[model samples]
Target: MQNDDKYLKSKNENPGSGMPIDEMHELDRTLGFKERRYIEELRILTKSTAIDCIIDDRFERIIYVVRQGDMGIAIGKGGDNIKKMSRVLGKRIEMVEFDEDREVFIANMFKPAEVASVSFGERDEPVMVTVPERGDFGLAIGKGGSTIEKARILVRRFYGKEVGDILIPNRGNL
Candidate 1:
């Protein structure tokens, strides 16, 4: 039987302009409910501090933006606070250090992947990341490929650095 309903668009179809309010609310309820909950949890966890927590619906992730003075306290000794928060929230939590200088902050995020060097080019630059001999390429990329992708976006957005490619160095060859 042929489906004649014009409103029944495929999942890939983008709801264009002039969309109904109910539709927008439905979309948020469907896709953003969990994310909103996560953001609320972060706010509750850091309510004592002046940190700003933002939930990115597009990325479905939470960012904890903290001032310099509160950074250490937000991430308690041995990361105990973060570990507890992660357990209680049941979502992957990431901390983004807010700096008046965005460039430095982006550079700091890129440090965790063991990137040996970063250089800027006119169009797109390559990032060389060093890994131990037994390092798994999958681990470097991270679960569901979210870690590296987030890092790349953070670098580009904060520093205007175009990372077209990522190179993982072979430790055995070092």
Candidate 2:
């Protein structure tokens, strides 16, 4: 009987721990509850649409992307909602607006310097952007070209492609 039991145990012991599906389900349930509550709180506070919520357990942070016509309303009066949410969640909360129009979002990203256009270069490839003249090209590129570089990195990191070119339109060209 003891030998038989040992053989069964050995057979049941999977090499890869048999995929933690039960644990994942539990985590999903917990996250769902938290997300629902957070959405409710946000609705009460701002009356804006919470487009998406990303909970990063490793960083202990919650990133909320909201679709709002007015950023002020999403942030709340005097940043009260953000403060409250951060305190309640016990995690840093970052807010970003979700624009229905892709152009609007891209334009918003290149602040101060107006973006003329954003066009995809190739499939699974980099993007090409056109920006208006804004005094210092260095500023547009950012310190040590960090700004544009970071944007490129983010594009590749998020979209799985590099940005082929970034063109700043010259007054002479126009």
Candidate 3:
């Protein structure tokens, strides 16, 4: 987004600190030329609204990070962009505005699903996230783990936090 933190720009060396050099290299390799092309096409599709996009192959999803207030622009007047892009890319497309705060960023990625909390653990271990109810948890995880896969990837890429799993609270104990 236009108001997003400057660190998220591609010119920056890293989105955040403490990224393993190996993971960075692997990300570039994973993206390669083909994947990068998809992102490029999307950038053109969204015009100047989107800063970048993520092609999460593991989950078959494409996430576009639009400028702070341009989600509508990326989505088009009536979701034409989503329909056309999905048809072209053959993957689910989601548009989310950019944010720098760790918690806000994670919550935005899991839109329509409420996040109870996000806890950071050991340096090498994945972080933990708490959600409520089976239905909301399903939303957080997506139809076949599509959304959560993006959550993990973006969390790592944006905040350098590795997310392990999503947890649900015990309502019976309350």
Candidate 4:
């Protein structure tokens, strides 16, 4: 399907658009009734706009992609908003700040884990994320690969990209 010509314009070509990449790039990110409800609940609770919401039943969590610059509000003072939202939603709450840059967005998804670099693989291959430290590998991947899986899902949702895997120095793909 053809995206809006405006949505296809690059930042350099459309300077000062004041629109986030997620909004600019049209994808198959249609929200379901439950996802919409969750987003509405979060907006009421934190007064932050969620551009996308993913319900990962296997992980028992709802991941909200808050607009950039609105994380502080979505998180609220001392993370009260997240705590409250989690309680109300009856699941773990994960908030990722929206970023126009693909690399920065990937790094944001793997919070607390310092990403050394983000690289794209060959055609049909997944994106490769490198962590600074060996320990960070586990942190980025999360227990049972939940973190990486979630990151892959969101990356595909917004960018239509895949996360091949994460790697660290010395050791190969994990």
Top candidate on lDDT is 4
Over 99-161, each residue of candidate 1 has an lDDT whose tens digit, in order, gives: 544334444444354544444433344443444423434454666766566656655443334
Q: Residues 1-174, candidate 2, lDDT per residue (tens digit)?
A: 012231121222311123233421222212377775776667676676664456656456675655546466867788887888788778876564545454454444444455678775455555666776645344546555544654553344223445655576654321
Residue pairs with colliding backbones in model 2 are: 126-162
The top-ranked prediction according to TM-score is 4
| Pairs that clash in candidate 3 | 1-67, 1-68
Residue pairs that clash (backbone atoms under 3 angstroms), model 4: 126-164, 127-164
Which portions of model 1 miss their true places by more than 4 Å? 1-60, 68-70, 87-90, 98-104, 123-139, 169-174
Looking at model 1, report the run of 10 residues with the lowest lDDT sum: 1-10
Model 4 C-alpha lDDT per residue in residues 5-24, reported as the tens digit of each score: 43333543321224345544
How well does candidate 4 score on lDDT at residue 118?
Answer: 87
Taken over the whole model, the C-alpha lDDT of each candidate is 0.49, 0.52, 0.67, 0.79
Better of 3 and 4 by TM-score: 4
Candidate 3 lDDT, 1-174, residue by residue in tens: 233455343433444333444454333313456656766676677664555667766767777776666677678878887888899888988877776555666777788788888776665777777887767788888777777877877777665558777888884211
Worst-scoring 10-residue span by lDDT in model 2? 1-10
TM per prediction: 0.49, 0.49, 0.70, 0.82
lDDT of 2: 0.52
